[model samples]
Target: MTASANLWTHTNTEAVDARPLDADASADLVIIGGGFTGCAAALEAARSGASVVLLEAQSVAHGGSGRNVGLVNAGLWLPPEEVVAIMGEAAGPLLIEALGRGPETVFALIRDHGIACEAVQNGTLHLAHAPSGFRDLEERYRQGNRFGAPLQLLDRAETARRTGSERFHGALLDPRAGTVQPRAYCTGLARAAAGLGAAIHEQSPVTRVARSNGAWQVEANGHRVRARRLLVATNAYHAGAEGAYRPQYVAVSYCQFATAPLTAAQRAMVLPGGEGCWDTALVMSSIRTDAAGRLIVGGMGNSEGAAGAIHAGWARRKLKALYPALADLPFEHHWRGRIAMTRDHIPKVVEFAPEAYAVFGYSGRGICPGTVLGTAAARALLGAGAEALPLPVLPAYAERFTTLLGGYYEFGAALSHAAAPRLPV
Candidate 1:
């Protein structure tokens, strides 16, 4: 199915309207791509009194921003100790502390802007798919507490009560995180930015980016936008910049299937507190309930690929394994999105030219990091200096064998999905 089949498109409450670029324009800042990163940057820059022009190849949140599982998770997928070990002492804690507060930033924006997205702050659950998974969570719990994070380690009984399943050995709950209707949040950001005087144009795909006379000139749909600063905030949906540098990373596909709203009796037994969840299996899977009580189940694999049937079968089996009572539920919606994963699984900021930065590679975490990083990139580009950014801006970054690695991921996921559901219950 096409992206039009996405649940978010049909259920989203927030709306934004913009025309394609019709005439030549100049601004203090020009941003490309209209996902969480681009819209958040535009909002921040415009609020700071800068003339910002945001150009989108498609509509706002048309990419992963719209198709995300809507978990406003805190920090990266890696634990605090792993992050510190990989990023070193100084840079590690900076990024960790910044992202640790990512959920707060997201919730604050939703409240301050009165965004109509189904914003839920009841927290999220990281389930242990097996005994080994629970061991990993124990270490994560220790490191998280060391960093002063408010984390709770729930026993198997508690996990079963919370998730309405006995499949997990235990769970780690992060009180700071929750879920939102991602697409609505992105649209609301663009609307809020436009209200603050940021010029946003949809269907204005940038064809070329060139530096002329100490300014960046962006060509899009027969019009030119000249700006003193530029930000390429296209993470996974990057398109059409002929000569400019492109963000490089392996593209991993994730698909989700949602059932029709359950009856009140069914809802009462499953995630009564409305917390989003994901398991610790190597081939990760996610679960959550929307405000209307539809159960969404997602996993790693392309639902639009040649093995699409295999992935769909896995979803059905997965639901049955988790909740036998709901085994007969039919999926009402299904969709997929791509994730840009770096070699180190860390987000990168590449200062490709004099006053331009390309930010991408959020791995599987986008919503919060995109907002935090996009806002910081705008400040730095507006003369806040590199000190404002959470990570150092590199001159350039490249990854070899991206296509091969991406194919490997898809093949592994398909092979695993086709084999078995491996019911832990």
Candidate 2:
């Protein structure tokens, strides 16, 4: 499998391999997918001294991992109170409390492994797109504060000052959140796992995986590998496989465009808080600066190729509206990738057999949640129970023909965006 390029085509990292599969191999575990989740699980399992084999249909970070918003945010898509209400007081609070520690886990790994990705730990701002959104932020703030989160709600002027954009009513700032160079980060995990003795194979498209004689026989590229446990980490890029767990999902895509690094004079006026920021618009958009000061602005992406031109045009206008000072600046890179979303905006894990499970769906929030959950899942498998895992394992949210939903979400986002004026600074 060859590596695919996306908005993360930065000069800082180059993909390491595109090799073939292992022939007649057996291991304690076989993980499918090469994105953040797969890499994290591989790293965790290998570090634990297990015999591990990670098979990627494509190169590492070849999916959403390479095309993410790069925000290492804390918590989940659901609010603290809402999570408590849904997962019930006991299980829900337990889940949120663990996820609340996500940023620290991510940052500590970055430091301990000495990964060279551009890791920024200052903070992140969640801006309210409307006054009503401010009320939502208020509730979230109270709930998060009660849970020991270091979050602050800022007024309109403070939000403008923090984001360097005056288009929001207010915002919730999470001090624990930060940003990173996503591809570099994913590759770092893979390298670390390999260093710890994991047998990671690229271009290994698993064509068949079946439970045979109480063990998993996984075939790929004319080779067969057997394992006691199997992990499926193919989320948004899952190629349909027979016997694979069907995931219920609506495809949501996000696109991004990056300007060349800002001049010293230009850098002074953008993201002065040195924090990543995204607004709570119906069709959300994120804005942030790279370590080199290149500003990336992203929003919903379209599956239709024709919509590319429209989104590209909209991005130009949105950039102008967000920062009138850089309205005339040239954009250097542009790309888009899909996000797997369930109706409830929660990820699901399904056990396909006695010892095999497939973990999928993260709606677009990939980095922290992906690693935190994926690593925990690997440990749970190794430990033979879900009790030690950080999240509540959701086993039965299944749907078919998920990839088709990509077009539907794109159409909806395109129509909604068509009716709105460009972002107003």
Candidate 3:
């Protein structure tokens, strides 16, 4: 593998030259973080005529939003019934319904804003990695159908034909989902928001935040930003801000390795229908093709850490296992991103202060939930009230043993990847 820079960063075209916040400024709303959620919120708030300012520690899409697998899935990793079970009938169904239209919200933004993110709304496949995994898909199919989702259960033969791999037993297909160049989408949102009069500052990390004189005073890059409301959309990449409450969640790492552009024959033979796919294994893995015909495969592990070599070795083995014909292809890009995982595997919108909220914990489903929740946060911050939000605003949300759990996840992923090659298909 060549192991160059991130494919998304290299391919992103929605360039925005937002300078650092260097002087005193004021806005109706101040947003921290410049990933999907922050950019989406800035766009919504600005379009709604609210004076908005967004600050980013790095450049736009510098966090998880830029490093994602680009799968714009419809809902959470949990099945519909499981969500209902954990969040209850009332709150659960509300989130489920809202996120079910997440793809629509995402694709609509792409279309309306003329984003060149290589959007493909064909669909996604949840492949069964084992017989038990197939059973899980069956239950998911049943739950999805009960919730009025137009899902299809494909048998082994159909799954093989669709994925170009005979390893899976079956698959659950969700037609409402799709993929995009994630970083481009995030930058596009920021571009659209800035065009609508929102002030965006990059490399201006917030250092302190305090409620003073019934407004938020945010210090960043030697500049003071006073706003009536504040929204912290940092998720897993949140840096400590004095007097600002940090979001609590377990941090899980996910990595991706992208091959060089495949030959036309290879592309035609693999994932020809252009559907994103992920298997149902415990240490979950994903496979998809980008617009440039590069095969991107991902798994749960930090690719830039101590276990990086193990993960890279496993990627080569995995590619050989999946497609023997393309075993020798080089991976031109390899990168990793962190995921904010909540205890119940649900995203949280915590009302940390009056008119100030901290939204995070997408649990691996960032693109859709980030867009939806960010838009809703903007509406609420602009006086739309709680009804405008998807999930109810919780007074507080906490997770115990975050550090220990994060360690456990990384250890488990490393062990699984080390053993994955020796396991039977």
Candidate 4:
């Protein structure tokens, strides 16, 4: 398979046909990046009667948005109290409450727009990889119940029945979460926004952004877009835009391998509830079946690097260990994407300038938080105050030793993947 080959891209039927910006244009808002955040913001702003122009470095959803695990989960990776501790007393619960409703926003958009992405709202599973992992889930269950989340703690037998695997010690099921064809979802958002009069330009990489004559001028594809407000939603795939604020976060790579569509019998024996799943290992891993019944296994390492073969080999072993019946099945699709992780594992909305913001650092939880933050950022840019947004807006946020930290994560993932086969499940 090619480097860019992804199961989502091949399976997606909803295509957003947009041209590159070929002429200077003016709008109320000009957005850089065309991932979920940018597309969601465009749709929201255009629906609110604002003139919006979205410029993409490549195609829509070409970044991490396209290469995600497709799990539309609620809230961040951190537990409720940890989030509250990191964000503060008032702001923490507010953000938590807002994100708790993120899946609703995402699913509503899919339903309202008639998006063709295979959106399954059957909920997601957080599997416990060991006895210690089960303890973590116990705490999470407690916290989730305190916050009124409809979460259930499943015993090992129930988890094995649902997942068709006896490797997990327990599982936490969150009914509010689900999955989607992430890339197709982003394309659908772009198409919906364009239908609402938003101008979305693909392959229009922004080279420079500056404030001039009381407007934000974004230069892209040899043309200029002058707008009253600007939003940088690039996340980890941000290239460079002069005078535009670049997000500072640790960039960790996540890679996935997908098998061919399983037979009906195979599908029936595996993930019968159609819920996406991830385990609570130190180096976490994920498993989910697509709408086409392809079993996708993902891990925390770059699949395009020297350790690619090792990770791929580990994935094969992992599949066999989890489901011995499918050991001979081969992966037909392989791809990798980067995640922008903040120190606190929380999403942020950075107020870079007046009427301008950069939202990113969803960690590995992009679908829900991206949609919520993107929509909130658009509302704020169009005159809604900070109170209207989900997360607290900061004047500036920075991370020190980002490259070192990113390297550390990569090294750890490589080591773990290499050592996985030696360790018994």
Candidate 5:
């Protein structure tokens, strides 16, 4: 099994290329990390007449943004009530309202920019793995409705009809959500930003960031970028010595497997509506089909870790269990990426200095929230004021026992996968 084989890389239609930065330059905003957030912010800031310089350590969408599940879902993994409780009454509702419009923001960008990312806006289904899961979905359905979301709870019969699998007890559908080729969407944003004179540089990893003489000076690949404002959007892939501050969050590993394009009959029977779905199990799993009719199944746990074989075996069993027709179909691609998960499962914006902000920790829902926050961050950083942001900018924030918590999650996922019932292919 080639651990680095990624479906998105193979099927990506959008492309972006750039040389590493080697000369001194300056801009109104300097963005680090060429993922969804950074690219989105670059596009927004540049379009708004602000000179932008985006420096990426690798190629665009090379991090979690490239390896995302592609589900353009609204809101966080936490329920609306949980988000409200965690964020409190005032800030919570604001965050929820902004995120609820996340899918809208994403799709509009695709439409306006003509990004060829196989954008699908049908909807997404939240499957209930058990009776308890159904209860949880019921609560989520209620909470979502109260927040003016057009959510629909489907019965088991309907769920089976829609998913073509009787494995789920029921499902909650969000009509606003959809799917996309994550890497394509990300690269498309970079391409669009670059076309608008954003000055995107690939392979330009930042070696140091400092406030020199009341201006932010970012050093990358032996080059310097002096800017009045700075935005550090490197979530889980923060590396090297970034002076002043670094993003703090627990790193959770998620892996995915994709089968070869299914036959027309098989594709018709499974997810014909092209709605992405995820289960309600404690160690949740996801299923969706791409434009080429390939089925993708993903779950928690790293595919390159010591328990790699266990995760591989569990994926095989899961594929067989979900769709017996493709029980013998081997996965054509296997890959993994790390997610920046905050303890409260909420994103953070740290204003570490007078005109510098670092945004990160999307928990697992990056597409929608990342777009929302990135756009808002651009607006705020370019004189729109911090009030334009979804969540209030904090002076500072920290998490304790991050390494221990990450290890705990990996151990629990491995144990669960190893204990799953074996099914004959």
Candidate 6:
């Protein structure tokens, strides 16, 4: 299949015209995968005066990076209490603190680099899918506030006013969160990294890695690039390479459908405040407007094969129900991606080898967590200081149930979409 039809078709926005890899090269660090984590590592390493080579099988941001929802929110899939509960008080607190600054770091980088990804800092709204969801948001707000999170709890009316929709009960807004055009952001980082003298190679899939005579030998695109350190930044979309490490996580699918730009009047009413919003349902939904006023609605779904059409239809109905003004608006873009989810829901950093690491499993919270963890990991990889990866690497096992679990999620998404009632707003 051509690259455009892949789950990450949003790459059309970032016009990086890099060619395929064809030559052998060497560097101080060899990073596999060119998504958020990989590119962030490349940028950080190059900025640190390390000779870094970043390789991607396809294009940069061709994976989940380009398929992102562009949400720059703090924390992970699990709530603060749950995170602390799973990782214990001290470790969880450190992680929360680190991620809390996720949006700050992201916006700073965007502004510094002038990446044109429609960077909007209007904040993000976490809407409640039900009363229980509101309670959950309340607890999260309390926990986040106690931990210095600048969060605001909004009632249903406030939520309606901000979102321009009355489907939600309530919401929690974090000023630290924002939105961006993801592909542009990734390409911008790559440009900044390359301008800083980092070597970035597209379509250079590293197929083998071996420690021969005390150096790491990485073979990709018929050439061997040797380095002292290696980084496996390929997350859920990883198709295993010969020598790279894979993080232990299940590949959960997240899909989105984008509508045509709203009419002038519709734009004035829908997401008029320019905030990115997501709900609290078990099968949740998200809403946001692009730089051109195109509304994007996303949720968990089977984003591949035969089930894609069903998900697409469900997205159509959901959009109409959410906004009566755009009831007849034809969706212009539909795409999906895999999110890495650990059984425990917290992200994982594995010490696969000496000076070699694999970072994955951000669940659905990519923007802030990915930015923070990727930046910190790059620092850690280069032996910068103690401020690298606040949480310790725990022993993890890749369960055999991952494929089955993925099938179940797909099954549920298909069944749920099929059962969706075509009710009018």
TM-score for model 1?
A: 0.98
Clashing pairs in 2: 248-399
Q: Compute the lDDT of residue 370 as modeled in candidate 6.
A: 71
Task: Specify the poorest-scoring 10-residue window by lDDT in model 5.
Answer: 416-425
Best by lDDT: 3
Note the clash tally of each candidate. Answer: 0, 1, 0, 0, 0, 0
TM-score against native, each model: 0.98, 0.94, 0.99, 0.99, 0.98, 0.94
Residue lDDT tens for model 4, 339-375: 9999999988999898899999999999999999999
- List ranges where model 2 is wrong by over 4 Å: 1-5, 12-18, 400-405, 422-425
Against the correct fold, how does model 3 do in TM-score?
0.99
Shift in Å, residue 76, candidate 3: 0.7
lDDT of 3 by residue, 1-425 (tens): 55537899989988776899989999999999999999999999999999999999999999999999999999899999989988888999999999999999999999999999999998999999999999999999999999889999999999989888888999999999999999999999999999999999999999999998899999998889999999999999998889988999999999999999999999998999899999899899999999999999999999888899999989999999989999999999999999999999999999989889999999999999999999999999999987889788999988999999999999999999999877754
Tens-digit lDDT track for model 6 on 1-425? 22124323543455554555577778888888888888888888988999988888888887888888888887776778888888997899999888888888989998998787889999999999778889999998998898899999999999889888887889999888888888888888888888788888898877888888767888888988888888888888787877567676778888888777888888888888889988887676789998788898897886565788788878888887778668788777777888887788888877777777777888887767777777788898788633578787644447468988987887887777776664222
User: What is candidate 1's lDDT per residue for 1-425, written digit by digit as tens?
Assistant: 33328999889989876789999999999999999999999999999999999999989999999999999999999898888888899999999899999999999999999999999999999999999999999999999989888999999999999999988999999999999999999999999999999999999999999998999999999999999999999898887587767899999999999998999999999999899999898889999999999999999999999889999999999999999999999899999999999999899999998889999999999999999999999999999978889988899999999999999999998988988655442
Model 3 misplacement above 4 A: 2-4
List lDDT for all candidates, in order.
0.92, 0.80, 0.93, 0.93, 0.92, 0.80
Compared with the true structure, the alpha-carbon lDDT of candidate 6 equals 0.80
| Span of ten consecutive residues with least summed lDDT in model 3 | 1-10
